[model samples]
Structures are given as C-alpha cells and as structure tokens.
Target: MLIGEVARHSGVSPRMLRHYDALGLVRPTGRTVGGYREYSAEDVRRIFHVESLRSLGLSLKQIGRALENPSFTPSALVGDLIRWTEDRLARERELLGRLRAIDASAPAGWQDVLRIVELMQGLNSASPARRLQTVLARPEGVSVPVGLLADAVLAESDPNVAGALRWALARSGGDGVAALAAGVHAEDVDIRRRAVLALAGMSEVPGVAAALADALGDPDPTVRGRAALALGRRGVTAAVPALVGMVVEGSSDVDAAEVLGTLSQDPGCAVRITTALVDELAAPAADSATRIRLTQALVELPVTSVLEVLRQLAHDDDPAVALVASAWVGVLDERSAEDRGDEDS
Candidate 1:
C-alpha cells in the first residue's frame, strides 16, 4: 500500500502517519520507483498495532516503548493506563457535574455561568474558610445551586463550615430537602446527623417535616433526639414522647422543656405531654436524677394540674427530688400570690 492508500485504508491521516514515521512508532518498509513512501504488509500491521495502543490512551512515546522494548511487560503499563483512565474519568465526571449544576441554575449569560462555577469551586475548596465564605458571600440575585449545597452539606466535616452551609440551605428553602432526606438514610451516622442538622435548620417544608418525623425514630439516639427537638420546636406533637424522654434522661432537657412548654399551649398537647411526663415520673425504675429532671420539667407547664403533681412529688422519698419539687411549689405559690394581688388591685 502506498502512503495515501495506507492512510485511506487505516483511517490514519497522511500527515499523522508521517509524524508517526518521523517518531519511528510506525515506518513504511519500502520505497516505490518515484521514491514515494510504500508500506509493506508488515509495516501496515505495525501501524495497526500503534493505532490500537494509542486507542488505549497510551502516549505515542509510551506506545513506542511498548512496541520496541521486548522486556517491557504490559502488566505495569496496563496498570498505569487503568490509573490514567480512571483519573480522566474522574475529571470528566466532575466537569459533567459542574455543567449539570450550571444547567440546573439556568444561567442566562456566561457571567452567570462563571459565577455559579466559582461558588461551586469555593464550596468544594479544601479550606473551610473558603467554603463558609462561598456560602455566606453569595451576592444578591446570584443564586447558588441547591444541589451543590446539598452535596457540601452532606460531606462537610468542619463544624463552622457545616453550620454555614446549613444556614445557606435553610435560606434556599425546600429545594434540597429530598437530597438531605437521602442523607438521613445514609449508613454513615455522621452523614445522617449532618442531614438531620441541615433539615432542622431548613424552613418548614412538608417534605422536610415528614423527613424529620421519620427521623424521630432513627436507630441512633443522637439522630432521634435531634429530630425530635426540631420537630417539637415546630409544634409537632409526635415528638412529645421523645422530648419527654429527653427531659427525664437529662439530655438537652432544658431545650426539651422549653419546646414542651410551647407544645403544652394547646390543651390537647398539654394532656398528652403531662401524661407522658407523669408516666416517666411514676416508673419503678425512676431514680433520683430522673425524678429531679421530671420535677423540673413540670415547672415549664402552666397547667393547673402542675400544682397537684408538684404537691404529690414534694413528698417523694428521694430528698433531692423532694427538695427540687418543694422549691417549685414555693415558686408556684409566689405566682399565685402575685395573681391574687393583681386581682385585688
């Protein structure tokens, strides 16, 4: 085959084939009468081999070594090629993700596209400060993509940065709730915690509320407690049992008590929460510490029944419980006296 014919048959451009020959990766083995390059069958076969190696992402230099070095085993070269291909694939995947985020944002101009890209890069930066600034510094009218924020929120390890990202997601509204919900179901406890944290900070979207409600029963106690706390603050009475448990258990019991007080503003919730607390108080396993916490929780409830419960608790066998409950009784007495004074006036 002549040069042009070989180029035509092998789909190698004539100029590239010449370059390949100049590099000695592939060379025609014969010359025609006109001194035009001519390829023997062996040379054509070598060209095919070179093209095949090139297709596997081998640099031309590497291909030359592979073809010429009899001692060069393919195992090492193949391993290197795998690593290179994986790196290229990773870069391509990252670029594709960035493009998708930009597309999702529906940027109207190149400047908008570039701004979104910069925000994404900053969020993914190695520096926690950069990530936090990326979220906190987003200019007005330049909306950060929620998917990118979702990814960052799930993966962020730095506490300050994570808090900032959660804040940004909350301001983004319900856009990332589904993504955060998926994180709630992640096998990683940390990721589940982060997801719950982000969901808790988010505005009250129905889906986010539902996700939080489901999380109230998470196998992880931390997850359960956090979810219950968030739901309770939002007045979801489903968290009543867990919130009461937190109070009796003395874990975030202060906040738990406050939320319970808010929940008790409704008469029905008051009865349910009071019943739950009373049940904990009367448990045979209730210890002195548990009894004290339970006693303290009653002070947060303004229901008239609180006085009777405290009066009954004020006589408990545990001196600590008696002391705390008796103190609360006096506190309640002062309020009743003040009310009478107001009424008399």
Candidate 2:
C-alpha cells in the first residue's frame, strides 16, 4: 500500500503517517519509480499499533518507547497514565463545581462572574485564616449563593473558618437549610456535627428547626447535644430527652441546663422537662456525679415547678448530691421570700 492508501485504510492522515515515518515510528519498506513512499503490510500494521497507543493517551515519545524499547515495561507507564487521568478528572470536577456555583449565583455580568469566582477561591484557600477572612470580608449587599456557603461550612475543619461560614449561612435565612440538612445525614461524623452546629445558629429559619430535630438522633453526641440545645431554646419539647441526657452525661451540661431552664418557661414543656430530669436522677445507674449534674440542672427550672423534686433530692443518698440540692433549695427559698416581701411592701 502507498501512503495515501495506508492513510485511507488506517484512518491516520497522510501528514501524520509521514510524521510517523520521520520519527521512525512506521517507515515504509520501499518507494515506487517516482520516489513516492510505499508501505508494506507490516508497516501498515505498525501504523495501526501507534494509533492504538495514542488512543490510550500515550504521548508520541512514550509510544516510541513502547513500540521500540524491548526493555520498557508498560506497568510504570500505565500507572502514570492512570494517575494523570485521575488528576485531570479531579481538576475537571473542581472546575465544574465552580461553574455551578457561579451559575447558581445568577451573576448579572462578567464582573459578577469574576467576583463570585474570587469569592469561591478565597473560601477554598489552603490557609484557614484566608478562608475565614474571605467570609468575614464579604461586603454588604453582595449576596453569595447560600448553597456555596453551605458547602463551605459543611467541609470546613478549621474552627474559625467554620464559624464564619456558619454566620454567612445564617445571614441567608432559610436558603441553605436543605443543603445543611443533607449534611446532617452525611456519613462523615464531622460533617454531620458541623451541619448541626450551623443549623443551631439558624433556628429561626423555616426548615432549620426540623433539620435540628432530625439531628437530635445523630450518632455523634456533639451533634445530638447541639441539636437538642438549639431545639430546647426554640421551645420544642422534643429536645427534652436529649437535653436531660446531655446533663446526665455531663457533656456541655451548663449550656444544656441553661437551655432546659429556658424551655421550662412553657408550662406544658416545663412538666415534661422536669419529669425527664427527675427520671434521670432516679435511674439506678445515676452515680454521685450524675446526680449532682442533674441537681444543678434543676436550678434553671422555675422554682415552683421543681421545688418538690429538689426537696426530695436534698436528703438524697449521695452527700455530694444532697449538698448541691440543699444549696439550690436554699437559694430558691430565699428568692421566693424576697418576691413575697417585695409584693407586701
């Protein structure tokens, strides 16, 4: 076959075939009387082989080594190609995410597009301070897409950056609630915790309460505690059990106790919260420390609501428990006395 026939059959262009020949990739075996290049069957087969290697992303130099170097093993080269392809795919995925974020922002012009791009880059900066500064420095009236903020807050590991990202998300009202809700169910324990924390600050948002409610059952105690505390403050009685658990477990007991005390302001929820605390205090497994923490938590409740429980606990088996409970009872009685005195005067 001549060069043109070889090109027609192999789908390799004539110029490329000539280039291959020049590179000693597939030199034709003979030439006609007019001195045109002619290819033997063997030469045509080598052309197909070169094309096959190119399809596998082999550079011409690599192909040359593959075809001509008897000592060359394909394992290392193939591994390199795999890694290179993987890197390219990762870059493409990142670019796609950026483009989606920009489109979601609904940029009005090239400037808006550029600004969103810059903001996204800052949010994803390697330095935690840079990410935090990016979130804090966002100018007023420049609305970042809430989804972008949700993604950043969910993935953020740095404490400061995560806090700033949550603040940014809260400023968007309920917009990021769905994304954060999805993060609440994420398999990554850290992500679920972050999502709950972010949602905790957005309790006023429409869907936030429900998401936090769902997070109350999260496997991570931190997630459950944050969710329970947020809901407790929102007057949701559903958080009663978890809040009592937090107090019993001595995890964030102070904040949990404070929120529970606030929740007890609702007459109906007050009964349930008090009962849950009393139940935990009465549990057979309640150690002295657990009883003490539960006793302390009772101080947040309305004195009238928990006075009976406190009276019973004041003489409890554990000296530490009795001491703490008696102290709180005295404080409550003194306040009650003061209220009555003021009324009379």
TM-score of each: 0.71, 0.76
lDDT of 1 by residue, 1-345 (tens): 899999999999999999998998888898889999999999999999999998999999999998999998999989988998999999999899889899989999999898888888898899998888888887887888888889889999999999888888888878899899999999999999999989988867769889998888788878888999999988899999889988877888988999999999998888887888888999999988888888899889974858889998889888999999999999899998999899999
TM-score winner: 2
Model 2 error, position 11 (Å): 10
Which candidate number would show the highest lDDT if scored against the true structure?
2
Error of 2 at 300 (Å): 2.1
Expressed as tens digits, the lDDT of each residue in 1-345 for candidate 2 is 888888899998999999998998889999999999999998888888999999989999899989999898999999999999999999998888889889999989999999999999898889998898899988988989888999999999999888888887887888899999999999999999999999989858898899998998887899999999889888888998998999999999999999999988888888988889898888999898998998899889998899989988889888889898889889899999999999999
What are the Cα lDDT values of the candidates?
Answer: 0.89, 0.90
Residue 272 error, candidate 1, Å: 1.4
Candidate 1 runs further than 4 Å off: 1-96, 109-111
